[model samples]
Target: MTETTENKDLVQEENVVTEETVEEQAELTVEEQYEAQIAELQAKLDDEENRHLRLRADFDNLRRRQQLDREAAEKYRAQSLLTDLLPVLDNFERALQVETTSEETASIVKGIEMVYRSLIEATEREGLQVIQAEGQPFDPNVHQAVMQEQDSEKEAGTVVRELQKGYLLKDRVLRPSMVSVNE
Candidate 1:
């Protein structure tokens, strides 16, 4: 062959050999393709693990909310009962209003006093309490000042009298007390 034709053939052969060498050294067959697929599966597994952790955290928060609701239900179970007992307390006050000293009336009064004491004790156990209003400092959040009186003995702005009692239920104010403040 001519020298130019021989050189062209050699160039073509070299190009083909270079392409074959590149393919042989790559190690890119079905097995290496499986490795890439396995890497993708591993990434999916990591994502699933992250989603599982998020689900677990959400479950924990739901459990805490349920626990709080149950505790609140248990703690406030006495509220309805105490609301029903308020009229009975009013009746007791009406009985105290009668200033009679007959022996029979006195016995009835004593019996009513014992029952009242038992009721107060039971209410205390149930978290119902009477707010201390006599001689306490005036607190607008907890006490309603119904009267103001001049007092030289107690400090100014101090409560001198209480017209009604207030109560609290577990750090929450259920009622405010009516009181008289010293000017």
Candidate 2:
């Protein structure tokens, strides 16, 4: 072969090799771009999933708290009205203590006693309970010591007398017992 023809043949081969390399490089670039886009989309999907889980948990907690609050409200629904009626009960008890002078007075007292008993029964049914104070041990949670007296017959810290009656509504104290404690 002549030198020019040989040179032309070499140049054609190099051009073919360069064209294949350029095509391979373009395909690799497109593949790499697709991989990067897929990775970005996956990350976004994962973040959204985590956020949704947190929001669901928050809603569940809120719903549980609200249910507990509603139950507590229902349990204490009549507390206010019961507290207001305590004074009326006390007056009824005081009225029943009056001395009767004649048959008419005795009948009136007996009638008052019947009405008082009815009131007591109704209140007891609604969870009203009398706190026992006299001769019992004084407790700060259920009894208020208004007077302290030195009493040798009673043990120290014992309730000597109940000045004013205390009452309970279920497990809660409506009024603490006003008592005189032995020192």
Candidate 3:
């Protein structure tokens, strides 16, 4: 072949090789881009799933807390009414302590005592309890120190007497005992 023709053929061959290299590079770049896009989408999906799981967990915790609060409220529903009735119970106990000589009066007192016992039973069934303060060690949490007395028989900081009774509703203190503490 002529020199010009040979040069043209060489140029054509180089162009063909360059085109094939460019096409191959383009295909590889396209595949790499597709993989990158897939990775980005997978990360976004995982993030959304984690957020949903967290939200669901938070909702479940909130529901459980609300249920516990509701149960607690129900358990203590009678506390206020029982607390208000304490004074009446005290009066009943005081009346029973009075002495009467006549048979008729004694019979009436017995009836009152029966009623007082029934009332006490009902209160006890509902978790109302009397705090035992007389002759016990003085505790600031359940006893209110109204007076202090120096007593030879009792130890210091002991409860000498309970002036007024204290009460508990379940585990919670409704009232603290009014007491005289030995000092």
Which candidate tops TM-score? 3
TM-score, one value per model: 0.79, 0.80, 0.88
Candidate 1: pairs in clash? none
Q: Name every residue pair that clashes in candidate 3.
A: none
Would you list the rank order by lDDT, best first? 3, 2, 1
Which candidate, 1 or 2, would have the higher lDDT against the true structure?
2
Better of 1 and 2 by TM-score: 2
Off by over 4 Å in 1: 1-12, 21-42
lDDT comparing candidate 3 with the true structure: 0.94
State the lDDT of candidate 2 residue by residue for 38-154, as single tens digits.
999999999999999999999999999999999777766667888998899888888888888999989998999999899889888878899999999999999999999999998
Candidate 2: give the clashing pairs: none
Cα lDDT for residue 23, model 2?
Answer: 95
Per-model clash counts, in order, read 0, 0, 0
Native-to-model Cα distance after best TM-score fit, residue 107 in candidate 3, in Å: 2.6
TM-score-based ranking, best first?
A: 3, 2, 1
Cα misplacement distance, residue 22 of candidate 3 (Å):
2.5
lDDT of each: 0.85, 0.92, 0.94
Candidate 1 lDDT score at position 141: 86
**Model 3 misplaced regions, further than 4 Å:** 1-3
